[model samples]
Target: EGAVFIPASLAYLIGTNIFGPLAYKMGRSFSSGVVNAWNELSIPLAKKFEHLLAPNAGWGFAIGMVDSAMMPIMGHLVDLRHVSVYGSVYAIADVAFCLGFAIGSPAISGSIIQAIGFKWLMWVTAIVNMLYSPLMILLRNPSKKEEKEVSFNINIKILLTQSKIKE
Candidate 1:
């Protein structure tokens, strides 16, 4: 989405004489900072809210969607204004967003769970957004022996197939 939006927004800005490589650079930097902050906060937020809610829940997804929508808008804003001002504004917003995620997530989850119930939890989450979290429990890692066997089988198959094609 960032890839898609950055070019489009840049093109629009370029048409209006507002786009420059510096703008792109600043936007990319801002995006990296925002993503890093979100990832760092996610685990702590999940842990804090865990007792009140379940894993594989939609809260992370909700926050992700909001962040996604925000990035391109921020990019455009920085493109439209002076770099120092835009950077400062984005810094402030980033701080607010991080603080909000850190503080609000657990509080919100606890309140929702208390006021209603887990059923309402799913409903409230679903109504607000949608995202699928994979079940890690259903996954398995290959043993060392199994890994060697799979690699050997793949190599043998490739050799036989190549020899046959040479005929």
Candidate 2:
């Protein structure tokens, strides 16, 4: 049971990667509606089928299949297309997917809470969250925190070594 559960959980985790991009491309309403529909549809489908078909397992399977299919296609596109074109397209898609997941998850939960009292504010925030993706796309060369940290570490090492030499 535990073994089955772990794999099912992992599949669900991997599935999100595929679904995230799909959701971004499809728009929120379509993406969410499809997912909801899938869940609803599965109940009847699972009963008719003899095999064990968990929702989480289904999600994971779908995600894995889609990602596997995408990687090969992306590779071919990269090989055929100009580097900049391929890179830009991939970067935009990646960023959009990340932004959707990062922003959308919390925003949805928070918006629901806000809607209980501050309905107008909730609407405003929803708009802002929707706007964030375009702003992210526009700001292509944002500062990378990891690079900054690495530079800081290097500087600190140099300063420490210099101080030791002076001693």
Candidate 3:
């Protein structure tokens, strides 16, 4: 457990740190596909670690990597769907995503997991998200200039600084 725990935590930290910034340049759906695809590797991992009583370092790490990357990707995904929002109207978009994440994730996950075991659930999730990603790329949604790109760095910068910078 100790071996698995440390490696998994480290992997999650690395994934979120690395992918959070990378997700900026890669765009939302693309980066999400990259992360979500990590679950497919778990099939091989499940085989590799089948003898172990608990999650081995590799299995834990792989799941950690995907799970960690998924966190920040959620924000990017919200922005993907709400790219053009700005000013007072941005609050609406923010609330919508927050509500969906806070309320919707549990609702969807419970039903899905009840029908499928954990391992198969991950595989299904991985395949479904990966399959749709290229379609999202092909069917680009047109929007205003705000939709084109967002500097997440600016948000980080604001948080670090004591004073807020006016945009």
Local distance difference test scores for all models? 0.46, 0.51, 0.54
For candidate 1, list the clashing residue pairs, or say none: none
Q: Which candidate is the best by lDDT?
A: 3
| Candidate number with the higher lDDT (1 or 2) | 2
Q: Which candidate, 1 or 3, has the higher lDDT?
A: 3
Give the per-residue lDDT digits (tens) of candidate 2, residues 1-167.
34535554677577656655553344323233233334434433344333334654654554454444444344444554435357766676678768877987688757665656444444444455444534433222333335566789999999999999999
The local distance difference test score of model 1 is 0.46
* Full ranking by lDDT: 3, 2, 1
TM-score of each: 0.34, 0.36, 0.45
Model 1: per-residue Cα lDDT over 58-145, one tens digit each: 2333333335445455545555444535666678779988887787777777787788975666554543322222221111121223
Question: Given candidate 3, what's the lDDT at residue 154?
Answer: 72
Worst 10 residues of 3 by lDDT: 49-58
Residue-wise lDDT of candidate 3 within 1-167, one digit each (tens)?
34535654665566656655554455534545644456444543554444332333334444444444444544444565665434434465568757877886788778877888666777876788678767645423434346224567676676768455533
- The residue-level lDDT of candidate 3 at 69 comes to 42
Query: Ranking by TM-score, best first?
Result: 3, 2, 1
* Candidate 1 segments whose C-alpha is farther than 4 A from its true place: 1-69, 81-84, 130-167
